[model samples]
Target: MTSVQQRTLYQWFEESALRQPDHPALEVGDEVLSFAGLRALAMTLAERIVHKHGRAPRRVALVASRTVAAYAGYLAAQRLGAGIVPLNPDHPDQRNLDIAQRAGVEVALVGGRSAGLFARLPERHRPTVLELDEDERADGPVPEGTPPAAYDLDGEAYLLFTSGSTGQPKGVPILHRHISPYLAHNITRYGITPGTRLSQVFGLTFDAHVFDLFATWGGGGTLVVPSATDLYSPVDFIVERRLTHWFSVPSVVREAQRLGNLPLGRAVTLRHSLFGAEPVTAQHVALWREVAPASQIHNVYGPTELAICCTNHRLTGPSARWPQYPGGTVPIGVMFPHMEGVLLGGDGLPADEGELCVRGPQRFDGYLDPRENAGRFLSYEDGGRAVAYDGSAPLTDRHWYRTGDRVRRVDGVMVHCGRLDQQVKVRGHRVEIGEVEAVLRRHPYVVDVAVAALPTDDGETELVAAYAGRAVDPAVFEAWLGDQVPLHMVPARIRRLDGLPLNDNGKTDRNALARILATREGS
Candidate 1:
C-alpha cells in the first residue's frame, strides 16, 4: 500500500497510469480517456515540446478546458518539469495576457478552438503558442522509454494568480513539496480508488480545481468533467454520470436549491461530499444532506497559500447534526494531521478568537514577489506567541503564514468568523461586514447577501447591504433588519438586486457591489 509520505504528485499519477493502463482516467460527455491513452497522448506532446524548446520549458500556460488536450497538456508540462499557468480562454484577453506575462511562461498550449485567445496578446508579451489539433485522441502506441527525473520537490509546480487588495493580481507559486502531502492526504482520507468517479466543476483558475485534477488522477479514479450547462443543473449531471465524489463551493448548492433542482429523496451515488472556497452554512448542508443522504458532508477550509485545503469537518451520516458557529456557518474543524496552526488575536498572542496562522510542510515558501510577502507572515516566540512581523526582513520557513481569516473555537471546533479586514467602525462601533451578511442570509426571503462599507456624504462610513431573493418592499426589509440588530450594526442603505454579482472564481464580488453603491450616490 502506498503511504502519504511515499511519492510526489507526478510520481503517483505515473504509478496509477502504469497500474491501471486500461481504466477510465478522464471523461467529458461521451468521450473517455483510458489511463494508457492519456499517458501516450501526454508523452507525444512532451516529445514535441522538447523538440521545439530544446530543453523542457520552464513554465507553460494552458489556454483551454473541458477537452482531452487540456489534461494531456497539463501532464505533458509535468513530465517536462515545467510549472503550469492556466489561462481561462473565456476570461478577458487582457487578463489572460497579463497572467502569461506575469508567470514568465515560455510556451502556451492552446487547446481546441481557443487558439485565437493568444492572438490578442501583443507580440512582445506573447509566449510561443502551440495550438491543439481538432482531433485530440492518441493515435500511436505508448512511448517506450521512461522520462528522466526533471522535477525537484522544491521546484515550482504551478503559478496561480489571486486578486489582491491593491486591485492587482498576486501570483501564488506553489512548490511540488507543498502539494504532494495535500494530494496524499485527500486521496487516503476520501478513500478514492479506481472505481471512484469524481466531479470536476471548478474553473481552471480556481484553486479548488487542484483537488479535482490531482486527487482523481493520483488515486487512479476517474475525473468526470462537466460542460458549462452541467453546472446549472449539477444534480442532473451527478445522477446521470453516477459520480461517487462531489466537491464544490456552497454557492452551487444554494443555486441548485433556488432553481428547484435539488429534489427531495432523490438518491445519489456520491460517497463523499466536500465544499470549500467560501463559508458553508448549516442551511446549505441541510439542503445537500436532504438530496444525498448517504454521502458524508464535509466543510473543507484553506487558502491558496496552504494548498487545496488545510482542515475539514465531516458529518458522519445524513442523520448526523451539524454544529453552528458564531458566524452562522459550519465549523471548519481542526487542522490536518500534516499541518500546524495557531489563532492569534490583535494583540499578537494566542487567543480563542483571532486570525488563523499556519506553518507546515504544505505551506508555500513565499509569494512570487518579495514585496507581496510584507506582513503576510509572523515570527513566533515561546508559549506559541506570534512575534512582530517585520516587512523589512526576508520571510523564512520559520515564519507562520498569516491567513488573514478570523476564526474562533466554538464547542472545541475552530469556526470561521470573517476576514480580519472586513471590520469597519460605524459611530465608534466596530461591525464585521461578514456578520451582517450572515445575519441577512438567515432571513426566510433572502437567498444571498453582501454588505459593504461605503462612504457617506458627511465623510462618515455607512454600512450598505445588498441582497438577492424574492421581491419585497425595501422599507419593510429595512425596518425588519433594524429590529434584528443594534442600530449601529444596521445598514444605512439596502439595495435589492436580481442576484449577487460573482467574480470569475464564483465568490461574491463585494468590490463590484461597492461600485454600484458609489454610482448611485454620484447620480
Candidate 2:
C-alpha cells in the first residue's frame, strides 16, 4: 500500500519498479537504465540527500548536464519533500547565482561530471553544496533493504523564477496540492493505467515535464528519458526504444519532418503526441500530419502557475492544413471539467471578453514571491487582487491565478488573445520584456532600449530589441550580450533606435514601437 501523504508520485515510482523492473526507464544515446534500476538509484540518491540535509525538507539548488543523473536528482528531491530548483547547465556561472539567491536555495545538488562546479560559485549565491557519489555507480555495502523515507507534499515542489514585467525575476512556488490533481486528471484523461510506455523529450525545467512524468508514473506507465541528441534524431532513438507516447514542442516535430529524420513512412507507432508551450500554428500541424499521422495529436494549453495541462484540443482527422487561430481570440477548447475559468473585465466583474481568470483543482497556492502571489490569486466573491477595485474591498477566499493573458469569452468558450502584461513567450519559455530591456541598458553604448515579442509561425514567438546606443555597431552590442545571457534569452533581431518613445506615465509606448515595426515592414 502507498502512503497517501507520500503524494501519488512516490507510489508511481514504486509501482513502475515492481511491474516493469527490466523495462528501460531512460535512454540517452548509449546509456540505458531499467525501471527497477532507476527507482533504486532514485532511492539511494534520496537517502544520501536526506542524510546531507539533516533529514528535513529544505529547498535544494540542483545543477547538472542534460542526462539521466539530472533526471534522477529531480525525482530524488521530490521523494524527500524538497522542491527542485533546476539551474540551467548552460547559463553563465554568475547569472545562476542571482536566481539562486533570489529563490533562497539552502543547498546545491551537483550531479554528473559537473559535480565540482558548485564549489566555484560566488559565496552569496552558493549555499552548502552537496555532490552525490552516484556517478561511481559502484554497489553499496549490504543487501538491498527498504530504508525509511521522508517524503512530504505540503512543502514547495519547485521554485520557478520567471521574468517579471518590470525586468525583476519573480519566483513562483509550485506546491504538491496544486500539482496532484492535474496528475490524477491526466492519468485518467490519457488512460495511462499500467504497463504504458511514455517518452520524455522536454527539459526538466519546463512545466510540461511534470505532465510527462506524472501522467506516466501515477498510472504505472514506464518512462523513457531521451538525451538531447536523441531528441532530434528521432528514428534511431524512437524505433530502438519502441516509444508509444510522447510530449514534444512543435518545433521538434517540424524539424524532424524537414530533415526526413523520422520513421514516418509507416513504421511510426506513436500512440499520442502532446504539444504545447506556445500557439500550435498551422505550419506545425502539417508536420504532425506527415510524421506521426496515425497518432492522436493533442495541443495542450496551460500556464506554469497551473498544473501541466489544464485544457487540450485533439485533432480529429488528418488534415493537410490548419486554420491559424485568428488574432482577437483563439479557443483552447474547454476547461478540464475539474478546472473552471471566467472572463472578467476591468471592473472585476464577469465579462464576455476580458481578462482570463482561472479557478480549478490544479491552481497553485501562490508564488514563491508572496507580494506577486497576492496580485495573482483572488476570490471571485472578492475583487480580484490584480485589479484595484479602485477602492472596493475583496469578496471571498477561493484563490484564482490571473493568467495575464488577453482572452475573450464567446458563448462559454475562452478565446485567448495577446498578453495584457509586458511578457513574451519565446519558443516555450516566458521572457520578461523588462529583463531584456534592463540587460540592453547595461551595455556601455546603449542609452535607451525597448523590447517586444511579436507572435510568429510554427508556434514560435520572435524576440526583437530596439535600442538607442552611442552610434556603435549593433552587432558589437549583440555579441557582448551573448556572453551575459543564455542563448535562448538573446534577442533574435536588434534595431538601433534614436530614443524610446514614452507615454505620459513615463512608460515606453509599446503601441508606438509596434507602429514603427509595422511601418518598416510595409516599407
Candidate 3:
C-alpha cells in the first residue's frame, strides 16, 4: 500500500477498488454497489461533467443525500480534481443556492427529491444541473483512454459551510493533504477491513460524513446507509445490517431510548461504537452498553476545522470502572499523539481549565473567506502572552486553531466543559449553561435538557431551561435544581418540551432553543 502522505484523497478509493473490485462498497435502499461498479459510475459521471463544462470544473456541488448520486458525485469530483461542495437537500432552497454561489460551483449533480430544489433556484444563481435519478445505472468496464487522475494532494478536496457567529455561513475548505493523515489514522484505529460494515448516520453536509465515505472506502469496508425510518430505530437497523461499526451524535441514543427500541444486547454485531458532535453523558454510555455489550465504546471529540476528530477516550473496562466526570459526560481524552494541545485561560496563559487550542497536520489552513480568520487562531510570544491572529498576516502552520470549546484536565484526561460562548453573565456572576443542563439531566423525568441565557423585560440576563421527558411539576423541578446548583444558576423559568430541537448536524440547537424560550418570556 502506498504511504498516505504520497496519495491524494481519490487514491484511497482507487487503490481499494483495485484490491477488492468485487467487494460490497455501498448499500443504500435495497441497492448494493460493488467497488468496481461504484468506481465505473464515478468515471462515467466524471466524463459527463467534463463534457458539459468543456473542461474539468474547479468546484462541483453535490446537492443530494443518502443516494447513489451523492456518493458517486463525491468520487466523480475527486476524479476531476475539483473541490466538492456538499449541499443538503433538506436545507432551504435559498440557503443551498447561497452556498453554491459562494463556492463558485460550476456544476451540480442533483439526486433524489433535490431535483426540484435545484429547479427552484433562479437560473442566474443555479449551476449547470445534471439531474441524476436514484436508480441511475453504472457503465461497464473503464475505457482504454480515460482521463488521468487530476487531483493533487495539496489541492482542496471538499468545502463545507458551517454557521458563523456573524450571521453568514463560513466556508471551510479542507485540502487533500489535511484529510489523508486523518483517514489513515482512523481506518487503522477503528480496524476497518473489507468485511467491516459501518453505519452512515451523518448527512453529507456534516464533516463527519467524510469519515463515513472515505475511511470505509479507503479500507474496502462496506457503508450501510440508513433511511429515515431506520434512523428512528437504530438498534433494529444495526441488527438487520449486521453492522460492525457505528458513529453518530449522542442525541441519537436519547431518541432510541424514547422510542423504546434500545433493547439489551440486541446490536451484538457491533465492534466499535463512536459518539461525537456533542458531549456523551454517562447515561448515554450506560444505555448504549446495554444494547451492544461486546462493543468498544469511544467518546470522540473535534470541531469541523480539525478534520473529522482529533481526540478520543475509549471505555475499556466494565461500565462500573469507567471514570466519572463532574457533568456525567465522558472525557474527550488526550489529543492524537501527532497533534499538540494547550489550554489557555482568560489571562492568555496556559491553565488546567480553559479554551483548547490545537495545531497539527490534520488542521486546515484557514477559512475560504480570509476575513473570517480574524481572532480564530492564536500565536504565543516568548512562551508568555497568547496573541490572537488578526488576519493581517498569512496563516502559518505555527498558528494554533482556537477551538472556542472550554476544556478542563481531570486526573490527566481532558473533559469538555462546553463552548466558551455557552458561558453567560447572570447578575454579574458568570455561569456555564452546561453545568445547569448537567444538573437538570439528573432528574428522573428529564430525558434531555438545554439551558439558554436570555434577557428578561427588566434588561437582566437569566438562565432559561427547556427539558424533554415525562411531565414534571415545574415547582418541584425548580426546587430540585435549587438544591443542586447555586441560586443564580437555577433557571429563571423551566419549560417542558416533547424533545429538544436539533440542528442539521444533530447537535442540540441552543440558538433555536433560545428563541423558543424568548417567545415564552415575552408572553
Candidate 4:
C-alpha cells in the first residue's frame, strides 16, 4: 500500500485531471486551462525537475507573474514532492533573495521581470531558476524515466512568510491535511461543486488563496483568474467568465464601486463574494448590498495561521451599526463548524474585549521555523506566582494561535478592536510593525525605525512610520521605498521617533505605540 505520505500533490492533481479531463479548471483572461491542460503542464514541469535536479524535497520558489502559470508551477512542485515558496515580484530584489535563502530554496521559477533580480543574488544562495514565459508554451509529454517522489500527506505543501514584530520573516507551513478542510468547508458553506466558477482576484500569497483554489476544486467548480490590468481597473469579468462566485479583499469591490464599473444587477450570475484580507466597514458592506443585492456578500474573518477563514457574516440589509459598528451587528461572525473561537478578557478569562484565540481544523499546526517569540499569543494570567500563568486562564480547547489582535466579543461574535501588539491593520491588510522596520533598517541613512498603524479621518486605515536616520534626502528615501514595496504597504503618516519605546522587558511596547497614534490623531 502506498502510504498517505507518498501521495504527492501532483499525483492528486494528475488523478483529478484524468478523472475529469474536460472540466474548465483555470481561466486567465481569454485563455482557459482545463484540468487536463493544467495537469499536462504540471506533469511535464515536474518530470523536468526530477530529471534535472533529482528531486528530494527541494525548495522551489515561484515568482508568479501570470496567476494561472504560477498556479501551474506550484502544482508541479507539489507533484515532485518538493516544497513550494511563492515570492511577491514586488518585494525588493534583496529582500526576495534573503527570504528565498532563509527558506533553503534550491530552485526558483519566476517571470521575465523577476528573472534579472534573482540572478543578482550570490551563487551560493541562488537556486537554479526556471523562467515562465511565452516561450515555455511547448507542451511536452511526461517521460517514463521520471522518478516522482511519493506524496506524503504529513509533509509540508508550502511555506508562507509572515513578518513578525521581531523585524524578521518566519515561514509558516501548510501540510496536505491543512489544505483539505478548506475544500470541504467551502464546499459545504459556499455550495462549491464542479459546476461552479469562482473568481480569483487576490494575490496568491494572500491567505484567501487556499480557499480560492481548493473550494473550486472541492466543489468541482472552475477557478477563474482575471488579468492583472482588468483587476486593477474598473472592470468586472464575472459575467464574461460566467463566474458563479467571487471572493476578494473588500478593496477590489470598493474600487469597482468608486469607478461605477459594477454590473451587479444585469450580470446576476454571481452567487456570492467572500470578502476578507481586511476589515469590512459598514460602508463597504452597504456598497456591495446596493449593487449585488441578489449575490450574497459574506464577511470572511481569519488570520493567515488559520488557513484562510474560520468564520463568516453574510451581508444582508445593512444591519443597525451598534456602538462597535453602526448597528453593532457588524460581526466577525460565528466560528466555522470545526473551530472554537474564544473572546478572552484582559485577565485572560472570557472578556468582552481581549485576544481572540482560534483552534480547529483550519488553524495551522506550526510554523516551519518555530519562534517561541512570546508575541503571537496572550497567555493570560497577569503573570502568576506560579510563573506559568500570565494572569490569564489556560486555553482548555486546544493549542491556540494567539492572534495578537484585540477584539470585543459580543454574544460569541468577535468584533475586532485592533492589535494586542504593535501589529496594525492598514487598509484592511495586516501590517507588521516589524515589516516596516525590516525595510527601514536596510536604508543606508537609517539607524533604526518604528512602524505603527494609524486611523485616517475618513475612519479608514493608514500607517504611521517613525524612523531614525543620519539625515539623508527625505524625498529620495521616500522614492526608494515606493519602488520596493506594494503601494498599500507604504506608511501614510511618517513620524520619526528618537527611539522605539521599549518596556522593562526591552520589547516594543505596543500599547505605548497605540497611545502615540491616538495622540497624533488628537493633535
User: What ranking of all candidate models by lDDT puts the best one first?
Assistant: 3, 1, 2, 4
* lDDT (tens digit, per residue) of candidate 2 on 1-523: 1112236455556666677677666655567777676677777677666667666447877787656666677777776667778887677666777777787777777765656665676666567666754452415531243245444566677777777765667777777766777776677767785556788877766777777776676677667777667767765666677777878776776666667676554427677777787666655655556666677777778888786667776664566444445552235667777777777788788877777788765677665655665566555754443443211344232556788777765555555777788776776787878888888788887788887776555346777778776665657766788877767678877887777788999888988886675445311
Per-prediction TM-score to the true structure, in the order listed: 0.81, 0.87, 0.82, 0.85
Candidate 3 runs further than 4 Å off: 1-6, 116-125, 422-522
Inter-residue clash pairs, candidate 3: none
The per-model lDDT (C-alpha) reads 0.80, 0.68, 0.84, 0.68
Cα-based lDDT at residue 77, candidate 1: 90
Stronger candidate by TM-score (1 vs 4): 4
Tens digit per residue, CA lDDT, model 4, 161-197? 8765556677777776666665556677788767898
Kindly report the root-mean-square deviation of model 1 from the true structure over all alpha carbons.
10.4
Clashes (backbone N, CA, C under 3 Å), per candidate, total 0, 6, 0, 31
RMSD of each: 10.4, 4.1, 10.4, 4.9
Q: Worst ten-residue run, lDDT, model 1?
A: 1-10
- Which ten residues in a row are the worst by lDDT in model 2? 388-397
For residue 402, give model 3's deviation from the true position in Å.
Answer: 0.4
